[model samples]
Target: MASPALALIVGTLFAQTARAATAWRFEPPSTSPTEQSGNYTGFSNDTINDTEVVEGKVFNRFVQIWLENTDFDDARTTPAWENLTSRGLLLSAFHGVTHPSEPNYLASIGGDFWGLQDDDYYHIPENISTVVDLLEDAGVSWATYQENMPTDHFYGSSYTSHNYLNASAEDYTFYVRKHNPLGVYDSVSQNKARQGRIRNFNDFANDIVNGSLSQWMFITPNMVNDAHDTTTDFAAAFIEYWLFPLLEDERFNDDGTIIVLSFDENETWDVQNHIYTLVLGNGLPEDLVGTTDDTFYTHFSLLSTVQANWGLKNLGRNDVNTTMSNVFDFVARETGFENTNVPEDARPLLNISGFAGPLNSESYIPFYAPDDLTAIGAGGQGVFVSDSLDTSVTYGSLGESTNLTSIDSQSPWIVVEDKSEAKVAVFAKEGNGAAPVTTNMLAAVSAAVIIAAAVYL
Candidate 1:
């Protein structure tokens, strides 16, 4: 094995090469031809880029670039967005599943967000499966890239980067764990192999040049770049500086790849969860270029589209809810999957935020097991139920379970301490079946130990 001195020299050289290729300034990233290597990796052994050549019915690669909290009108009217619309199909009627950022992001991959309402950190129970589980099952490579994340598999709440724009600048909270969807799920965060796949922008640069890009990628820019803490204009410019050039690179976007550019949720919470969305890549038909699709699509559409394209199992939640999660029109056409047409009046109030769900509020309920029997996916596969799921009861029946005696215990939104440690589920012992109580701290560490031992050992 190489000594520490040798490692340091190699690291310094790689960083220098990455800096030169990216053409860094006091701004967002630019295009790079080869490896964009840096200290942004998780473990030295982490597989940030797990590449595979899986063929799909429609697109082989699916890349999701997420911006934050911009209304559909605001994004559409932005001068910077205009430049991007001409290169791909504009999804005029696309909507976010819920308000705030985290839930919609979770919904994008895991079929359902499990009712958690705010940006507070919380990990979904392991029994819940995600797109990563499906992809790996089907041999489709996937990974997530957070722009300014301190490390690849970081599970922290937030990190400030004084060196974001320039070294002399005051450190700012450029990265937040709430925005990184996979980090919120225990199945992903706790799994060593999968956790290593959570990389940063620098790794993205490295992945491209190494010819190691994954087939499925979820890319989240830093707070300022994603408009979470900045303006849509700033985000548009960042995209123009970064993603715009990559659109031309076949490694980034080929005829077999589909790139989704979307906002996490709309700024206007009063309106239905309408958000600006764009679909690009050479995978898009030439005839569809610069055109508009008025289909009623949601974040879950991406989930359905990917599953349909790759012939994978469904998570059996909103992803299978045809009315709520319609497949992309072009993808539907190619895959022989029919897109759902919901009447304007019959649509659910998507603007509805925080009605209390799993791991949400003070009266938090147990995570539900999906009904594999009914969750039929567009790929013609049933739901993929994990071994850890509690099959003794029906899904979402926690509130009615006889194990809970108190009225407070029956409530779905359980109150807990507001501390910011990683949220986890503590399965409380009942006279009968167990009920889950979520607490970040101010609870038994032994319970987690017992649960961990029970689940893993």
Candidate 2:
């Protein structure tokens, strides 16, 4: 028989172990490579670029975070105390609309698709209210930390490759400048005008190091750094790099803040229709780690959260239903932050009635051509082709030989994994140097392909 003292000691040890297990620390990754694919056509270049540029920074200042990192057990791994989980809130500003950058960023905060779509930065239209207005109205400080934003203004007319484009929309930056005039500022020193809220991506890094910024920040990486036209790994690397220091900040450890990572929108057309979104915070449940929230959400939902957080009035329509109340855990805790009280067994509102089947099914295929492509590339005139591994597979158009490879490359469509058939369209040459173009050819396929990978990190 065991002695009473031994039994008591065993129970005490078990309790201690459980307590220790409950304590955890979340630090941003050390090196965020601009790689990692998402649900789209062939490679996820845009995803990779976004991650790297947004997060990349000076090594000296950020290194201090890891050098003085600590576990969540209230133990002092570093003397200065850098507990990421408790102090920092990750506020990721996603560029939404389509794979192209500018419209996506506008959609992320504005909650509406601006008139001019596609990633192209030319022909910017004005008269759009942005989330910046809302954030400013609420007195929540915010800035755009773009990796290589030329001339500070979104429409500085650099005509450079700094723009992140997709097979669909190209040149995303100019739209932001056109839509939000408030972002333009007059430089008294130079006796000229410059962008107001916009700053170089590197400046954001300096702000993080200097602690000169506010509670909310928006980051946009350069063309290569932010995965605008690269792979998903690039984006991931950038995020991890920037996030590590913030999570390690001593102030964030003491105060409760939440960080979020999300994609603006998935590929132009099909496959998995959902985008990626991640939340990192000290108050979040530990069990929530490496989990997927496959809830049906639109870009507007993100806008709703920002609106609520900053006390912005609703934008009406779809934006009204964009509350994240369903996904967050609101139950109050010892930490004096607002609790989210989300249930564990909450069912996602997947539109199964609208959704047919997985990509592999014969009947599950979607209309790869006119419908999807038109939605993505309708506003512009260009041919774009995908980098699908299978040469036999064709999306959007019909006839392989006649379609101009040059035009096909400009086709404005999201690559759908499961397409039942292809469609095409042809346009006659017009007066303004517009050449006669033909698109919408069909090619048969043997199997279905899915572009999405389920990643839990």
Candidate 3:
């Protein structure tokens, strides 16, 4: 018979091979970092001066177009912004400005981006509460699961306190070295305030499965499994295998849970600029499946939607009126609205960059990174990106298809179209690296480019 140790090794290898074979076709490049890029990695500031990859043709043609425009400079110029009315889901290009990760997270839920300068753990501020408070006021149940929070304190934050319950918490602890083998000291010290709310990430699934959590639920992946990358392939795999299924459970029917997967912010420079948000949930249209939303949306818009849906009080300057408006329409009709505000012309916002045909395999870009940016009640502002052609598009308006034209270096302008409501901002690209050279003036070019592109578009 084969040796026991050898058998175990062979089995492990086979499992790894099988897992790799079946994993999602999309994988970060081999250059992915080991430490948590947290939110900023894989970002490139270069825009496509000319067609790097031609559009159309091949196995993953759309993927090709995405890759060709994949760079920091390209911006969220060509994403498909779907507005999910009663008909289908509308995805907007979710983008946040700034370098660190925490502030963007605050933007997504609380608005105003909270000015959280660092990702270091700190007690919640007294002046600033979260959208969780708003949800609670609106009678919406929500939960946040931090992986590894121990059972004795389901709301624990320390690595030792967390218990990975199959469904819920149980009174379990281990003793070693004369200390609670799982140290509860750190969490006890750090979470001096509002310690009741935090819980093990596992609890999120349990709450959803057991029907204990309210309609609104928030999940925070552990520092590692959240694609922060302590372990390679862990975050992406967890999302694909574990989290997606939990969100799809039938418990949410009368009022479906709108599941949003986003990054807190970019940490590394490479992947930060093109961070992505994946929205999956009930009442989403099937025809709009697998589409991208290219509208410029910051975290405040996300908070605003949650506020509107739950009837919660606004938290910051960003969420008040400037936030995106179409997110609530799926349940709007059901909430007894006579005529919903959802727009009719539904399709992806089109970008005419590199209109050349037939994309080659070399320049393919996959969406990565998810960050938060707040814009709600206070002195909050949301940044918009677009060219001259898009300025005429309405702000905060959803379910409309937009068309863009070629960007000549001489007239490079980006328009901000808010289809969810009514706002059109016209701005231009700044600086030139390797370029078709849209504008002649080298200094202060971004401002000049917008003026020119607006005039022509």
Report the Cα lDDT for residue 276, model 2. Answer: 41
Q: What TM-score against the true fold does each predicted structure earn?
A: 0.81, 0.44, 0.45
Error of 2 at 357 (Å): 31
User: What is the C-alpha lDDT profile of model 3 across 1-457, one tens digit per residue?
Assistant: 9999999999999986875564332232112221112122222222112112111111000000001112222222332222222222334444454445543444454444322343333222222345555644444444343443443233222233222321144422211111111112122222443233343433433443444544444454444345442222444444444444443455433223455555544333444343445556543445445665545454555654554444445543445544333333333333331222323243222211122110101111111111222433321223222121233322222122112122321122222334466433333333333332233432232343333223333
Name the 10 consecutive residues with the lowest summed lDDT in model 3. Answer: 58-67
All candidates: CA RMSD (Å): 11.7, 19.8, 20.7
Q: To one decimal, what is the Cα RMSD in angstroms of model 2 from the true structure?
A: 19.8
Assess the local accuracy of residue 319 in candidate 1 as a C-alpha lDDT between 0 and 100: 89
- Model 1 agreement with the true structure over 358-445: per-residue lDDT tens digits: 5454334446666545667988898888888765433444442221224223222232222366443444333454466444221323
Q: Which numbered prediction scores highest in TM-score against the true structure?
A: 1
TM-score attained by model 1: 0.81
Global fold similarity of model 3 (TM-score):
0.45
Instruction: State the TM-score for model 2.
Output: 0.44
Off by over 4 Å in 1: 1-26, 29-51, 400-457
Better of 1 and 2 by TM-score: 1
Runs of candidate 3 with Cα error greater than 4 angstroms are: 1-92, 151-196, 230-233, 252-255, 267-272, 321-457
